[model samples]
Target: MAGPLASLKVLDFSTLLPGPYATMLLADMGAEVLRVEAPDRMDLTRVMPPHDGGVSTAHGYLNRGKSAISLNLKDEGSADRIKALVAEFDVVVEQFRPGVMDRLGIGYEALKAVNPGLIYCSITGYGQTGPYKNRAGHDINYLSLAGVSSHCGRADSGPPPMGIQIADVAGGSHHAVMGILAAVIHRQQSGEGQYVDVSMTDAAFALNAMSGAACLAGGQEQKPESSLLNGGSFYDYYQTSDGRWLSVGSLEPQFSSRLCDTLGLEKMKSFALSQNPEHQVALKKALKDAIATRTLAEWQAVFSETDACVEPVLTIAEAAEHPQLKARDMVILVDRGDGSQQRQIGFPIKFEKTSCRAEWIGKNLGADNKKYF
Candidate 1:
């Protein structure tokens, strides 16, 4: 069966993580995506480390299922070629800073002229109309400016750098996909397309969610380790005897009781429920001491049958081999454009009727140029 987004065609002029990742999700869902890149100025992902079959693994993963066409936007005829393509492709995704696309002559307004119903999405650090719109920024900067780092890590050492690009993927890529799809639905209803201006900083600011709600409405400024879920209580990670970590999130009364019982710290159950800082500190220390007495495997065995929300923190390799991830088919194989296939992460969303699959890994620059140009 065709995927739900099989009917849509996208012309992607984005490079790097944010926009490419967004379009990648679209392509994975069966949208016909044509990625346009510059021949002279190659995307860094194409040459990023960890090559498989002589191709950058990052590029292969991000651009899977999408066709590629190389064109130098600086050329005088490039705008005309894009305009012609825009007539057929109903959606456009770009990631250039503010005014860059306009100077290239293929901004939203120009493309919308070619296809009035085009869903044009631009992902940026700030927005097209913000005071800092033209300023250059990355994921870390966006998170810092948006106050995400304020309440994220240990107050003593400051916010630790994240393992993943939270602002890029969650803020920019995910939000852009959501905005584009919303615009698609709006266009379906009103027969009019609109430009989607996604600001990573803005999205990251909104990601404060519960903390932001308290700050805005209740005037409670959130700090690191200052809230229940943020290590203010016993609901946090504890190191085992072997130095492996176990995340404990037994926040509810019943679960906390079970956790305390399983750890042989039943006397600390009332402290787990108490909001007093001293009680929380004592309960946390007791839990930590108990967890440290056993290796991760030993603790895993002890908690395996218990109803408490406790689980070992697995490495990426361990996670890939985990039963739940394996059962969910999170790891998949994509064609490498040769006879063989390469392992990659699969689309996460499950559909009842429709299906989603990658046609192939990312292709060489201009691999589909003759077909489109």
Candidate 2:
């Protein structure tokens, strides 16, 4: 079966999580994505901790379903060689700061001269023309600036989720992929390609569209924990019996009632007043007391029959081995050439006739140099 993006060709010059993940998604959808890495200084995640027998750790996971080509951009000869190859690709993605690519003579202007239909993408902490473009920032900074980190965590922690690189992976990669596809469509029509500058900060702002809307309607910035979506007594994570944690999302009255019925809180309906914090406290305490009486499995079984909107918080390992995941084939182990077969998250979107597959196998550094160059 032909993949949805089978005809696309992407040149991924960006490194680390954001760029690799974006290009990897394209590759998974059967695009010929070639990752350009430096011979000397590759992505930091390549050498970062949790090494499996001292091989590229996080890089292997992120770069799955993509080809790798080693090029020393600092070396004029190698850079020129890379520039020549860039003309053949449909899309080019780079995560460097504003002027780095232009300085290297491989920016959109340089590449578009050779291939007029090239879709060039630049992913950065800040946008190309922003005042903060020159400043160095990471995922945390982007989330912080975009108002994402403000309402992320529990009120007591006063900190966001320790994991989940919201800005880099979600905002950066997702935006880059969308922009690249959009540019491809536009280029097909106009036969002219333009530079796509995707700032992580701007992308991060997209995550809070609903919150922004609520703020606009109220004519005031919604306070943390006050919004219905944020941490309230109803839609929050709670500890279950046997010390396990589960998230409950019974925002609607029907769902909440169903959940209460499952937990045998149908009789404790007097404490349903969650409009005020003090009332929410009484409700939370009562719900907690009921949920603590039984194990997570018990609650799961009870909610399985209704639209309670509850889920046990599974760790990454547990999620990988989950029955639903296995039934849906949501995780698969791909051959990494080494002894180990790397586990990868499966393709998210499923189309009926246009089959989108995770095509390429895991590759090491400079794996596709011969094929790409």
Candidate 3:
């Protein structure tokens, strides 16, 4: 059976996490995604460590279910080939500096000429037009510039690096996918396509809604660990006696009361979500002291029957085998074509009639050149 996006065709000229991830999602939903890479300028992710079947694990995961064709965009022949492909592909996603695609002779305007209904998406560090448009940056730089890091760290600790690439995935990849899908719907109605200019910094800044609201609407600058969602309240993480951690999110009055009751801290009920620093400190200390008396597993068992949002922090391996994730089939086995199978995180989008699939892992570079070119 065909998936939801089976009719769509995408030419993915982006590399690394953001664009690749978006295209991967599309491919999972049955889009015909053709990954275009330079013959001599392969994506850096191809060389990243933790290789499986001589392919980078990250690449295998991101480019799964997609075909690949190598083309040197710097060459005139490649330019002509891309123009021919532009007319066939419904969507074109690229990640380059502002003028790089234009200089390559495959900008949105040029491609739109070939295929007027082409959904062209550009993902960059900054936008196509800005003082920092041409600046080079990664996920961390974008998050910092967007003021997201200002409210992410502990009160006394300097801004620590995030465990994941929040800006790259959320700001660039997810936003680009949203824009492309919206444009797809608009094209269906108006028979016209538009350019989606996605800036990582812009997307990251937009995701700072909580802090932005405080600053813009309330004229308040949020400090790290001083906001309601940050660590100003009883909602935080606590270390257990077994040296593992558990997240606590008993924010609502009912949940807070339940947590206090479970921990035998009835006196701390009034300070559940208090903004006073003294109250916050006292409540946090009391909760931490109570939590430290038990192991992570013991606390998990204790909270298993409750509505309080408390859960043990699991590592990546543990999460893969978690009951909830396992029941949902979030981890799937892929054939490496060498008499061996590899486990990978499965597609997330679930549909009743047209479920997504992971048909295969990423192919070798230019593996589909003969078929496409």
Candidate 4:
């Protein structure tokens, strides 16, 4: 079936997580994404992790649907070749340090000169211009600078790294995709392409909307896990005797009451209704103690009988084979011609009519050079 972005064509100049993820989003929607890569750098991810056929583990996971093409942007012929493809593509995505593209003569300005209707997006640690624009940093660095890392760990713990590339994925990849889509919409109406500069640090800060609002209102930044929503006694993850976890989200008074009633711990009823700061920890501990008394399945069986919002904390593996996932058709698998089929993080968005669905697996480096060239 033709995806919604079937007519969209993209030239991907990104290598790592952020840029490739953005292109993957579009490609899943049926856009023809042609990833451009230097044979040497070759999306270093391709070299990391679970691999079989001498291909980078990272390559097979993120670039399944993408086609590979090798080229040297430093070569004048490569730059010229890219320009020729620009006129035919609807979008261009690149993740390079500021001025790197301009230095190579393939920046947004140069590309727009070829196709004015092109939707060009640039992803960087900082935007194309700023006091920190030229500074070099990675996801954690950007998160630290943006104050996200400050609030990520436990309040009592020293600085700890936040797992999962939040800055690269949320700040860089996701933001770049949104910007590119918006530009595409604008281009359709105005027939004029524009440059999209996605700044990771700035984007990281944007994620501080809640913390920012709280801080603006004179709230002291607290540790992330301490947040009422994080895993307070009422809405926290409790470890059962079986070493499994039961995620309790009985935050609301009614849900808390229901959970208390289900736990048969009516003595802790008032704790659920307290605004007193001291009660937060006690209430959480009480729930934890109660939950720890049973196995994960026992708790699941208990919570499943109650209206208290609760569920088993399943791993990605468990979630893939979960009844809920099957009911919603969440896990999607595809054969990438590597003997074993490729598995991926599937799409969650669904449109009522044009329901958004993941249409392809990721691609390898420059996975589509011939198709584009």
Candidate 5:
């Protein structure tokens, strides 16, 4: 059967991770996405390292299943062409600063004039209107401004560096998809397309739902190691004898009791999440000492049959080969049309009937120029 968004059309003018990722998700769900590039400039990801068949691996993954066309928005003729195309497409996604598109004559109002039902989405660092609207930023800057990084570190050594681009993927890409879908639904009802102004910083700030609420609502600011979920208690990672790590999440009373018994620390059961600083340090040290007595694999075997919620941390390679993720089809093989295949992370959302697949990798620049022209 056709995917849920098989009938929708997306005109993607954004490049790089955030907007491209959002459009890729739509394309995976069966939307007809036409990625528009500049004839003079190209997405930097096209040259990003880790190549397959001489093409950037990251670009191949992000732009898969989407068509490409190049147009010079600087030219009047090209602007006219885009204006004409805007009337034919269902949505337009751009990642320029506030007034850049307006100067190019293809802003939301200009497109709305041609197709009033056009869903125009603008993804930016800050927003279209604000004191820092034109400010430059990346994942780290946004995460810091949003107060997310302050609560994500070890109490003694300060915050650890983030491995992933949380602000780019979670703040921008995911939220862009959400806003676009919401606008799509709203358009279906009102028959009037609207503008979606997505600010990465705003989205990052909104992600502070739990800790921020504690401070704002209950007057409880989250300290470095005082928050229960942030490492104030026994719910933390411990290094084992073999240098590997084990995560422990024995938060509840019963689970804590079982964990204490399993670790031969019956005294710790009563102090699972004690708020007293001295008691907390003593309990943590005791648990650490006990855990350090065994290798990570040995501890894994000991708690494998229990409900202690303790598990060994695996490297990326081990994670990819994990039986549980393999059983769930979380990793899949994508054929490259040659004798070889590329392994890619699979789409998470599953449907009972509709099919979701990455039909192809990123196309050559302007591969579909003739069709558009």
Candidate 6:
């Protein structure tokens, strides 16, 4: 079956993670995405380490199912070409700083003149109109400015650099996709297009959902290790005897009781239920000591059928090999256009009638230029 977005066409002028990742998701859902890259400039993802089959895995994964066309926006007549393409494309995703695209002559107003129903999305670190709008920043800077790094890590260690690009992916990419789709829906109703300005910092600030609510409405500023779930209570990771770790989140009374019973510490159930700091500390110490006594495999066996929300931590490779993820088809193989297939992460969302699939890995720059130009 054709994917849900089979009718959509996107012109992607973004590089790196945020905008590229957003367009990747759209392409996976069957959107016809044509990437406009520059022949003179190089996107870092194309040469990022860990090459597979002579291509960067990051580029292959991010640009899968998308065609490519090399176009230097600075060149004469480039803006006119893009304007002509925008007349046929449904959306345009870009990651340039404020006023950059305007200087290049293909900004939202210029493109909108060509196609009144164009969905133009701009993803940036700070946003289009702010004090730091033109400031140079990255994922870490955005997270820090958004106050996400303040209460994220251990109190003594400060905020640890995240393994994933939270600000880029969760903040900019996901939100841009949502904004574009919402604008698409609006255009369907009103027959008008709109400009979408996505700021990674703003989205990260919004991600502080529970903590932000507590501070804003309840007059409670959340700090690292000060909240019930953030290492203040027993709901945390426990190191096992085998050097592995297990996560325990038995937050409710019944689950706490079951967890205590499993640990043979039934007397600590009341402490687990208490909101008192001293009681929480005691319960956490008891859980730590008890969990330290068993290997991860041993604890896994004990908690395998238990009702408490306890599970072992697995490495990335282990996670990919996990039965549940395998059953869910989280990993898949995509064609490399040379008879071989490359294993890549699969599209997550499932549908009853429609399907989402990666047609092929990313192609070289200007691989489809002749077809379009």
What TM-score does each of the candidates earn?
Answer: 0.99, 0.93, 0.97, 0.92, 0.95, 0.98
All-Cα superposition RMSD per candidate: 0.8, 2.1, 1.3, 2.2, 1.6, 1.0
The per-prediction tally of clashing pairs is 0, 0, 0, 20, 0, 0
Clashing pairs in 6: none
> lDDT of model 3 at residue 147?
94
The TM-score that candidate 6 achieves is 0.98
lDDT of 4 by residue, 1-373 (tens): 5677888999888877889887887777778878788977656787777774565656655665666687889986877888998889999898888888888989988988999898889898999887998888898899889987776655677457865899999999899989988888888888888989899998999998887778878766756665676443366678998999988777788888888888887888788777665787788788778888899988877777788888898877888888877787676766656545556666666645554444344555555666767
The sequence of per-residue lDDT tens digits that candidate 3 reaches over residues 1-373 is 8889999999999998999998999999999999999999879889899998788999888998899999889987777899998899999999988988999999999999999999999999998997999899999999999999988888798688989899899889899999999999999999999999999999999999978988999999998887778877778899999999999998888999999999999988999867788998899999999999999999989999998888889999999999999999999987775767889998776799998987888888999999988
lDDT of 5 by residue, 1-373 (tens): 6778998999999988999999999998999999999979989999999998888888888998899999889986877999888889999999998999999999999999999999999999898998999988888998888888888888788877788888888999999999999999999999989999999999999999999999899998786777778888767899999999999988888888899999899977778856776776787899899999999889978998998888889987788888888887777776664656677777778888997888888888999999988
Off by over 4 Å in 5: 337-339
Estimate, for each residue in 1-373, the C-alpha lDDT of model 6 and write its tens digit.
Answer: 8899999999999999999999999999989999999999999999998999999999999999999999999999999999988899999999999999999999999999999999999999999996899999999999998888988888899988999999999999999999999999999999999999999999999999999999999999888898987777888999999999999999988898999999999998899888899998888898889999989999999999998999999998888898999999999999999999999998989977889999999999899999998
In model 2, where do residues sit more than 4 Å from their true spots? 267-276, 338-340, 359-361
Q: Among these predicted structures, which one has the highest lDDT?
A: 6
Ranked by lDDT from best down, the candidates are 6, 1, 3, 5, 2, 4
Q: Using TM-score as the measure, what is the rank order of every candidate, best first?
A: 1, 6, 3, 5, 2, 4
> How good is model 4 by TM-score?
0.92
lDDT of 1: 0.93
Runs in model 3 deviating more than 4 A are: none
Report every candidate's CA lDDT.
0.93, 0.79, 0.91, 0.79, 0.88, 0.94
Which candidate gets the maximum TM-score versus the true structure?
Answer: 1
lDDT of 2 by residue, 333-363 (tens): 7776664576678878777877766544546
What number of backbone clashes does candidate 2 have, counting pairs of residues 3 or more apart or in separate chains? 0
